[model samples]
Target: MMALRLRAQHRGFHSRRPSRARDVARVGRVNPPAIRVVAIAAACILGLTAATFPADEVHWTITGQNSVTVDWRGGDAEVRYGTTQALDRRVEAVAPEPLPFSSRGPFREAKITGLDQNTLYYYSIGGGPLHTFRTPPPRGGSGFTFYVQGDIGGSLDWKHVAECQALIAEGRPDFVLCVGDLTYGNSVGQHAVDTHFNDVMRWSLDAAYMPAWGNHEWDKPRSDDLRNYKGRFDLPNPQSSPADRRYPYTGGGEDWYWFDYGNVRFVAYPDPWSGAWADWAQRAEEVMAEAEDDTAITFIVTFGHRPAFSSGEHEGEPELQGFLGTLRARNPKLVLNLNGHSHDYERTYPQGGVVHVTAGTGGSNLEEESGSGCPWRGGCPEPPWSAFRAMHHVAVRLHVENDRIEGTVYCGPAGGGGSNTNDIACAQGSVIDSFTIYPYGLKPGAPKPPSEEEEEAQAKKPAPGR
Candidate 1:
């Protein structure tokens, strides 16, 4: 039955939308009264088609401290934004070209600039309905809030996905960050990715989605899977030498780039592939080392797919350990490292001064302990720098205020049932763990110069020592 469903989903990729007008006309000739009814229905359909699409899954993200990017699932990607909710007062805007309708889907995106820092603005897309978003202050005076999750592969049976969606709806975060494994394209097809987007569209109707690559993203080959991934989303690549070209290849590939929103500096790292793990690790180290100490960057957060320490059946990879070691060396307020792969939730303390969180329980099948002798598995005797661990389905809610960053893990019921239980196999809601991250070089009143202890702590430790 599951295989049949997978086949039908793959078949959908080859399907196309039919002409509604012809179908309506064909049905109208059956009877005069029916024709009259058909005419009315056709008129209504025409009106709906003309009034601009509903702009499904409307979301916003911080393009910069003073700029916000509004994106939606599909439709005329245009924004009619203003300082007032009336929308009568038009402001700066941009409209993407009409997207071609086909199974080879495309995700539309547009960035709105010239926004007032720390001010509230009302905006609407295609003259539809007005929505509101608050811009971050120019200097990062106060804090902000956002959402993060992983492995939500559009499973229709997982109740936890709906629960997490409801949590996001209530939280009303500034943006959403997905670590990896958003859609399980392995063993399935491209339709799995589409289904995942469809499910996400239902829940994330007002949140901007920031993503990192996962293993599932590379389940196929670069030619097949990479095309699907690149075609669907529009991410930032500021250092691209040739504009308008796809996949702006940087030192760490085009997908890897750095951007700043308010006081936080986010670095999106691509998953290591094709024996390039060591190269990726070295590049991450270089990027962190080049970041400024006081300006443009305050906090550094890195996200990828596989984890450095996991107790799942896959266990931890040695290449990831090398990458983590290099990343720890360039200590630029290394706040958090987010990942998804274990099909469960876990959070670790400041390992070598960096926090780690695994949020792989996003609507995927949970993997039980294989009881294998993998070093990171079988439960660490002393929790190997791990602050918290759980095998339940969950996601993380981040609240960034001023110079402090706080994160809370929202656990939901595990398994296919709806019952809420605390058992690792049963999904439930609870705060598994929480942590706060302070900006670099600023720790309240002291104002002292960089001490030797600080330098040694922040600097990369020798490879042998590590």
Candidate 2:
């Protein structure tokens, strides 16, 4: 797989204002044309400089079972790698091409393929720093952990930045699954993408990061145009690529895609707020049908930026509510639905054989009504599907194994604002919510492990068919 080519010129490079009076004067004296020429020359020599995230801290996207796409802000599009941390082997990445304006910089990406499955490999970008990554397990292999969150970026008071650092240092998730609301960019531009990448670079440096479009991603000043989002991330292009469509796709570029890991198949589609409802629904139906026919797939997880069922300030999308209700009716393998946009954490009771989880607590301001269901601002009663809710910032970790999928919601420090609000305060790094789902062979309400007393009582009872 070739790395995605730079499609447009961007100004993602962070420009620092001259601080000293003399420095400012010097900069002011420089001519625009001269500055442009100098910048172009520098870019030609050193590659575009990513002021926010250094080239060494590369952003990763899992493109296939044997390949991963690594992108960096400013550097030679070169990656050297091998199975060992020594990086004895190497591969030259595609060099960055020049854009129209010399002042703007282009994001450099390289697609590394032909890697050994389930093997640990160490790589360095432009010989900057040594980083390690593990490929997805071989087909049918089932033992991995991935993190999930949404609403990352912005709201410094929310502690998302620090929270993310801790997640990587301790949890070290294999990859990240984000439900959207990625950057709180007020507009559609490089600065917005830069700010978001800066906030999450720590996680991106270590693990493959996959995201679905959220309202904040597309509902910006340049509405409906996801050039930045699409250009930055190289998602699985199952429909467009010549390879057999492993799963159904709506042919929306990175707007939607699907991939598999171990026994789980993850399908990311757009919600009504992000894309056409009918188009995405059609893809969802196709994926469900495929999963139903493939007996090897033990779990089917779908995620997006907007929630199909959420009690946060934004509430749930009414169109999604109906579509999901029907989708889950016939697809039991579609056990989990992940989403964000509510600015809180919520888990629904098994509704129509599937559990919908809203994990919008990834930084950003905490909504009083998020997960609370009371709608501190006032409205209709809480929906019956809501099982667990919390206003604290959090990131979820899912342990996907052969028989079950276990999830643990790890909470971060409470955001600013005194205790008078509806937000729940919890010790940072505490597990606020946890649950297990047996998607293959278990009764509907049979999730959540039984208590010791219940287990003991069952043991005392006679065996079945005795």
Query: Best TM-score goes to which candidate?
Result: 2
- The sequence of per-residue lDDT tens digits that candidate 2 reaches over residues 1-466 is 1111111111000011111121111111112256756875786687544532345324788898898887666655567777765677666555333211111444666787888877777777766666776778866567678888886663232345456546644676777887776765533223434556656766676678888876555443333234555666778743321111321222345667898777788988663432356566766777877876676677888888777777765666667777776666556677888988776788998876678898876665555633544533324455677888876677788888777888898877666543214356678788889999887336555663443345678899998898
Query: With candidate 2 superimposed using the best TM-score fit, by how many Å does residue 299's alpha carbon deviate from the native?
Result: 0.3
Q: Which candidate should be chosen as best, given lDDT against the real structure?
A: 2
Off by more than 4 A, model 2? 1-57, 94-103, 154-159, 187-190, 223-225, 238-252, 273-275, 369-382, 418-422, 440-466
TM-score on alpha carbons, each prediction: 0.72, 0.75
lDDT for 375 (candidate 1)? 22
Count of residue pairs whose backbone atoms collide, per candidate: 11, 0
CA shift at 195, candidate 2, in angstroms? 2.6
**RMSD from true fold, candidate 2:** 11.7
Native-referenced Cα lDDT, model 2: 0.63
Question: What does candidate 1's lDDT look like per residue over 141-215, in tens digits?
Answer: 445667778777654433455566666656666567877777655434444565566566533444556777665
